[model samples]
Target: MASAENESLDHVPLFPLNAAVLPGGRIPLQLFEPRYLDMLAGCLREQRGFVVVLLREGSDVGSQAVFYDIGTYVRIVDFQQLDNGLLGITAEGLWKVAVNRSWRAPDGLNLGDAERLPEEPEDVLPSGHSELAAVLRALLRHPVINKLDLSVDFSSAREVGWRLTELLPLDSQEKQRLLEIQDPLQRLDRLSSLLDAMD
Candidate 1:
């Protein structure tokens, strides 16, 4: 991962979806549209990644979609041609970035000038938040989540918070708020409150 000191605001391809992905989470995508297919090819050929922003307005299949400015920058970890003839890709979120400005290419692909956000500092899960880790462990056991083969680090506050945000039944707006938070401990606290309310 590139350190914040070395990172700068640069134009990157953007993919807007109804879902949100946080750093350390992974999402599987199916590409059939010509615009996105071309974007995938460029990213793979350049060995680079694209931003996955949560759509705020319009449809994902159209050219007029609007998205939240903060999003995850993901790299394509795996790719294959599905039996249905669509391109299947597994993307792992590398970090968070804020889109300063955006434009559309002639091909109808969205591009953004994004600045990488600083990574959360390493912090151990506090003893009071042990329940949060336990809850995440249980959630990860679900067959659907297990199939993703995600790596979990219960000792890391950031890991636990991010995984829980991805796994929980929170709305996209709620998840986006968590993603924008810079402090892992605070995020964990927020998740705990959310879980308590869900019960």
Candidate 2:
């Protein structure tokens, strides 16, 4: 007989938020609110992953609160209880996903299921992508007050572009668009255009 727990996984748990969690990346969260504190507790108790659903449209409540469906399943990689009673933590990406449903919990926090997508290729990032990366590298090279601490994670020009884009403190909406673009090549193209426009 199939276990109900196993079956529930088929319909992944949704922990929707007004944010974009990139694949091949880490999302640090402050679990302060009760609803989210419960959400994290549930994850820990069940050992089941939850989806970080992105909110796009509607009022900040009920089904209307969520918009963009794509997201990544995140696992708590590290955590600590702060003096402010908030859980300071980092969630490491496990899978890219598309939302299958959206709804509101009794507490009025957001939640939704996400269709996990496979990862992009491990090949070289396109030339255009590399160009943007060069720009970013130069920018990072110049130290500044409160500079972003970054790490180089790409092997080729193409990956370098996308990886750099991920590292930057870009807007959540823009980052969500990048995660939704499954094609690595096309993603690099889009990133190239976005970075060029910024210049």
The number of the candidate with the highest lDDT is 1
lDDT of 1 by residue, 1-199 (tens): 3443454447689999877778789888999999999999888776688999988888888899988999988888888999999999989988999999999999999999998889898999999999999999999899978877899889999999999987898887898898889999999999999999999
User: Which candidate tops TM-score?
Assistant: 1
Clashes in model 2: which pairs?
56-67, 98-115, 125-158, 125-159, 126-158
Per-residue accuracy of model 2 over 42-79 as CA lDDT, tens digit each: 77777666676665655323444656677777666667
Candidate lDDT values, in order: 0.88, 0.62
Task: Give per-model TM-scores.
Answer: 0.93, 0.74
For candidate 2, what is the TM-score? 0.74
Query: Where in model 2 is the C-alpha error above 4 Å?
Result: 1-11, 58-64, 135-152, 156-165, 169-172
What is the Å distance of residue 105 in model 2 from its true position? 2.2
